[model samples]
Target: MAEWRDPQWEYFAIQSLRGKSFGDEWPTIPEFFQYTVERFPDNSAFTTFAGEQRESISYRELAQYVEALARSLQNLGLTAGDRVAVSGKNSPYWGIVYLAVLCAGCVVVPLDARQNGEFHKHLAEFTEAKAVFMDGDLLAKLEEAETEQPAYRKYLIQSRKDFADATGAKWETMWQMIESRKGDTTGALSSLAQIRSDDMAALLTTSGTTGNEKLAMLSHANFTSNLIQCVYPGLQEILSTDRLYLLLPMHHCYPMTAVFLEGISHGSELIFPRGLAVQQILQDLKDGKVTVFMGVPMLFNKIIQGVLNKVKAQPAAKQLMFRLMMGISGVSDRMGKAIGSKLFSGVLKAMGFDHIRILICGAGVLMPEVGEKYRRLGLNFIQGYGLTEAAPIVTLNPAGTSEVRSVGRLLPMITGRLESSPELSAPVVSVRGHEVGELCIDGPNKMSGYYKNPQATAEAFTEDGFLRTGDMGYFDRNGYFYITGRSKNVIVTAGGKNIYPEEIEELFQLCSWFEQVMVRGYREDGTEKTELVVYPKLSEDCVARIAADRDAFLSGDTVKDPAKQEEIIGVQLHREILADVQRISRKLPDYQRIGRVRVILLSLEMTTTQKIKRFLAESRFAQHNDGLLTESQDF
Candidate 1:
């Protein structure tokens, strides 16, 4: 009950807003932006960075563009409630289009531009979108396919290029449309006034990483409320002075609400990297002085891993010194002193993180070690948990008093309960829980329902109206939630033990030899057992160590034939990996321990967010030969 109280920072954050009008929440996202634009008209709202060059639009300037574009859409025969699809890479222009559609009182359907034509086509037809604003290249792909396009009444290009010649149609560029209608008279504002807070604002498709796609319907209140929820819980300190980095795909809800919407709502500068390249992001981070960085676990792990790898390559004395410094920083952390920034100033500057105020990871499981390493390095790092159905933000670790082991404490005003029952519609085998089970949530930020799929909408919630999160997790005594794994991904062993692959996969993440890892249950001798499929990323040191073990195994009579070298290496690799697996498995419960191990050279198939597609991974490698270095089970 103590955890259910209003967030401590809410009063302070709300009072700071102009006239303290946004105490609970704004009626709509448009109204919130309107307030911000009026409050910080000249403040930089959106910025795009490309190496040393950048472009920006102030809040006032962006509002003008949004108003013009909204009028342009209305003039082009679009009306209120019309579905408009917007697909593009992350950019200020993309944000403008998204806001403009909402301004026109139309539902914004944010489709994944990285998806293939068929995928785009399916979403368009599924939503029955009346118009589409697309990037030139993706539009070209649809035309190149020679298939009938989705029934779109108007096409607006996101790129600066006029693709009339290429497409044999006079498609208007987004900028051209906005500029041409800047002063044009329209009734768009009137329609926007009529748009209700409960109206469906955006139709977002759930990432089918688990191989299932459903369109989620989120409302204006959902988006607006969630942004408030994101802040008051911990990030109320973020101000107009902060620069929020947008690295993850903006089409996804995680970055959309966390970075894009959060930045603009706070009147902060929203910085978009020119490209997703690590170097490009680093350049932008340093040059732009971004204060907030929100990214997925994969990207964060890669970044932290790169840093640790460099430290590991250092001389023994230097490596030990670095650890000592980190330990010192950790002590300072517990003492409520932030000396990591001072302690690791050189390291921070080198990694372009010297100016970064907050580092947040979400969208996938993050190893606790990774989270601990970041804090010890003197960074304000936090992890959060959410799904699209919850307007994508259910919880955020309170910045100053974070519980790194848990995903985060529930956002202010969100109520959650754990239910232990496989009979529920959750796609899990054993919904185990005396303490852990499906996490069900209820809050104003929760989505209205799945788009047009009544059955799924019905199944997605409980009789009491709490949305079934389909994630297996439990709350700590302090209300911080720790996710075990997805309900759908639970592996039930023959001994009636449940194995959460993500939990085991995190242990493997601590090992430098693995690029990626996925655990699943396999049948052996008419009984279910744990098996591991891994993509190895052996370091030079790892190779040398394994080679030494191999030579010792053969009593210094190593394979002489060149052809046999590959065979010898393969056997040695399997033995080394298995030994490591056993070493790590000892920490896990006996039933959850891996019995068989398989090594694959080729990378596993992954979603754009870098989550390994579990179903696809299992089936794709089922027949591959050399990729599989199977070891006999002894567990």
Candidate 2:
């Protein structure tokens, strides 16, 4: 129906080059590296921008560094099956070390650099990691946390200064380890023949949203299979020359497999930002000419809100025209014709998405409306579902041929089933003649098991052997999978009605007043009510206005008492926010509508991965409610 929409998208995993290329289908990740090296030897593999200076390395250069690092580890007593941990921000060095460890036949443990020393020590002890590579400061903290260290431990410090000779000759660790040993590739070569596809390549911890932390052992075959799945037709159509902006933490599976590995396998250049500061991100986007953007829902929510809020605040005629255009664009999309891309081309360019062709959202539920907003803006926005155990990508919306509401079609060779259960926090909702249930999946991309945790691993699978996703979802008649919410996060009302907080939470996001919102069911006496814990950042203008009102009230004889003046301003602020909440609540069923609004000064606590820690939110809200600055409720 549209020029951008392609009706014919063949499933690629089934037809992947596993058996065709190099005579073996299940090749190790290191082998995948070798394949890319052979084809694009001098192509830009990695790049980092610092201030006005830019430094990068080619595929061949990356391979030599990986070989030297492998040899150095071998010299340091690293051997096959020996565990080694890597905790650092995303960098070419992080990528180099990960490949080198696998090339040396050791298991690579990807740790969160944002994690504290105690967590690192626990993971190191659990994996029995004999060596580690981490940022300099984190390294010292981890060492302090682990007292019984052996003498011959390997700790390769991952520094922030570029090692591209631009940082100077004497401070060049890359030159000392790699450039000096450029001629000799003898040591790491032999070990490559010994490693198998099924061998454990990486040991990564879960996001722990489902509960306690557990290590997921992903094999080389598992990741390699997922890489092929990503490149196959109907998925992200990334080119070899595309400069992918690598901003997310590399330790996470979303970036580790999807962007870093997948992009590299396709010969794409990986662009690292100067830093996470907003200016740095914007500069990298403009300078790097980034084509593919990957991020979570929170990031996109801010962008959508910023753009729409500006549009709404414009002159009355401009606001009306913009809204009308968006309405037409959204309508065009529903009919399978995305005229939005053409209609909103000017708006997209003005918003700095000029070079962005594909945008992927994951790690949390992306409300369908958010997806629709971007799609109507002419952006190829998509949402997917997966966890650390599934190599982080089981289903992704294929560009051009996509259902923005559903996550995407299941990747080729991946099978999924829904198991109905009533014991979950809320009753499941049926959609389009399909009943929702716990979505279980079985695939080659699945993890072997949780490392050293047999009990958790045993309970992770169904009797027939599908991995319990801990998520509830359903599938449309056309085979697109739709995620409802985390089964545990669903809230059951007193009327026995199922309310997916995520669904209700999305409705709240439609309002521009709140920065973050969490929907939860709390009981009072004999019944329960759904409440919204909102965190709003006041604008400079709002703060100034409040201050002016307070001073004016205090000076006036009509409000002579100092305490009474403060109360009047406080009441005014609460009523304004509550009025907006009440306006939005009408879209929901009376039972599902928010019964109370609790405004907090602080943000809702979130994990390092940017996921809301639901249990923590419940406990903290129950205990303190301090900074419970304002509230409006209907008891």
Top lDDT hit? 1
Model 1 ranges off by over 4 Å: 1-25, 154-156, 159-170, 185-193, 233-236, 423-434, 538-576, 621-626, 633-635
Best by TM-score: 1
Query: Which pairs of residues collide in candidate 1?
Result: none
- Cα deviation of 191, candidate 1, in Å: 6.4
Q: Could you estimate the TM-score for every candidate?
A: 0.88, 0.87
Give the Cα-based TM-score of candidate 1 against the true structure: 0.88
Per-model lDDT: 0.77, 0.75
Residue 144 in model 2: lDDT:
76
Q: Tens digits of per-residue lDDT for model 1 on 9-92?
A: 543455466334442344567767777787798999988755467778898888888889888888888877889988888878
TM-score computed on alpha carbons, candidate 2: 0.87
Give a tens-digit lDDT track for model 2, residues 185-258. Answer: 75234245377788899998888654577889999889988877665566777778787888888888998888
lDDT score for residue 219 of model 1: 91
lDDT of 1: 0.77
